[model samples]
Target: MKLSPSVSIEQSETGLEFINVASAKCDAKIFLQGGQITEFIPKNNKPLIWVSKNETFQEGVSIRGGIPICWPWFGNHQNPNWPAHGFARTSLWQADEVHENDEQITISLKLPMKQVNTTYWPHQSALKVEFILTDTLQVRLTTTNLSNAAFSYTQALHTYFPTSDIKNTTVDGLQGAQYIEFGEGPFTQSEHVSFERETDMVYTQAAVQQHIHTPDGIINVSRENSSSCVLWNPWIEKSKRLSNFADDEYLGMVCLEAANVLEDKVTLEPKQSHTLITTISWA
Candidate 1:
């Protein structure tokens, strides 16, 4: 495969496959296992995505940060033993296409449906993820139902963003949206969102865009075909329970996910398709 200066196939110490990119404007690292992006840095700005310092690049295991693809299901599954965020993040993906210009590189990967576990899925489906790494980062996840019956699922681009100080950071553009935290009631967001303690909230009727104000600068996050979003910071306890995360690591990162979950779950009829898109940029 002839790739640009910004793109190449690399492997982790444990033999995990990844696409490494370094362009004139930015740099990134993407894993082929889940079509997951583990790093994105635009020019002189700080890292827009964050990975756990304690993370071990192992096979069939989801990495702790960057943007993890949560597909088919968003959270804890009905069957508790099943994977929390579906199997996509742990499954291998086939790189199907690659396109590059002078300033940007785009790579596409497709899920191997024949090898997928049919136990959870309904209706024949097709899954694809694409990453466009330029000065900014853009991701697109597409799903198509090829069967005669309709099917539904929840999904998200579980994006982890870095912060100089988590407590001082605030997220904007979510005023008036309703959210639920820890299975609580539908509360409304009256102001820009900020974190203090352990925080996990899912917002409904969300706007198409939001902004994260960190000490360094503002990062813009925009989404398409998604009316729901999730915000999470372990703050303390849950961080200890996570496999690759440190107990105090929550203070350095925040998860502002672009999601289609709960009331926003997507249902597709025969031959129908849906695409969820998210873009991130920092100046």
Candidate 2:
């Protein structure tokens, strides 16, 4: 892979390789492991993505923050012993393309199926993630089915965002969407979402965009090819049980993931493809 002047391959102390970008528009870091992006900061603005300070950059271990690519499946699988999220977050990816110009930088990565354990994912498919960075950040996850048979799956770009205070942060633009929290009813959202306790809400038929009101400013989050999303914050007790996460870190971050889960799971026939896109910027 030929890297431009603004981008280079970097390795962590734990031997994980990632691509680092520093350009006129923004600075970013994307790990080859899991095809995950751990940082993105625009030229004149605060960071739009957040990662845990306690995160360990070990091979096969998913970093606790940033945008963890949940693919093949999201959350729990049918078998209790399977990994919580799919293997994509822990699998290594190949750098397929990298381009930089004055306006922005684009990096493309492909997940090699040979690295995937067939025991978990038997179907033949192609998965890739492309990051387009400028004063704003855009992530595109595309999957193409290669097998003759049709297959279905659920996924999410589990993006974590920063906040000066979770108490004052609120998410707007989900009005009238249906959500299921803690396996409860698919209740209708009557107002903007506020965090007071542990929140694990799966929403369907959501609007294409939402605004996150943080102490720093309002962040605009928009999605395409997705009608579902997730809002989560592990407050208090649950925060204590999380690994590679500080107990009090919940107060400073929140996750509003653009996803395809539950009723919005994707099914593709042979030769078909699908893409899930999410873009973030200060409003």
Candidate 3:
């Protein structure tokens, strides 16, 4: 990939390669290992993405924050031994293009199918992720079916956002959506969601836009081609068992993922394509 005035490729101390963007509008980093972005801070504003202080930047290991790409399958497969959240987050990606304009810098990356193990994902398809960085951030994940047969898959843009205090944070706009918590109750949401304990809610029929009210400010989150999303916080005990995360780190972060799980999974015919998008900005 050619270097631009606002973008350049850099390697971490652990040998992982990533693209760094430092333009007038923002500063960000996108790792090529998982096609994952671990940082995004708009100029003159607080960070819009949160990464764990103890995250491991090793080969084949997913970094613990930012936007992790969960693909092909989510959470777990029919077989219990399969890797949770699929293998996309640990797969190496090829940087396809980088462009810069007056308003933003865009980076495009694609998964190298040959590097992928067939045992995990045996389909012939193309996966690409694009990052649009300005004062706001936008991510687009596009999957294209290249084989003659049709296939179905589940995925999510697992985004982690920061908060001064989790207890004071609330997520609005899920008032009428249906959600399942800890494999229980496909119940309806009646008010703004807040965090008081470990939360893992999978929602369906969610509104296209949601607002996260943190001690810092209100962050607007919007999604496209997605009706399912996830809200999670490890709270205390669960946070202790999580790798690459501090025991009390849960107090400073929360995840509002744009996902396609359960009934929202996608099925594509040969030559068809689907794009799942999410945009973040200040409300």
- lDDT tens digits by residue: candidate 2, 185-225: 89999999999999999999999999999999999999999
lDDT of each: 0.90, 0.95, 0.94
Off by over 4 Å in 2: none
**Comparing 1 and 2 on TM-score, the stronger one:** 2
Task: Compare candidates 1 and 2 on lDDT and give the better one.
Answer: 2
Candidate 1: lDDT of 161? 93
lDDT of 3 at 119: 91
Which ranges in model 1 have alpha carbons more than 4 Å from their true place? Answer: none
Ranked by lDDT from best down, the candidates are 2, 3, 1
What is the TM-score (0 to 1) of candidate 2? 0.99
Model 1: lDDT equals 0.90
TM-score for each predicted model, relative to the true structure: 0.97, 0.99, 0.99
In model 1, how large is the Cα lDDT of residue 278?
A: 97
Cα deviation at 238, candidate 3, in Å, is 0.5
- Residue 28 CA displacement from its true place in model 2, Å: 0.3
lDDT of 2: 0.95
In every candidate, how many clashes are there? Answer: 0, 0, 0
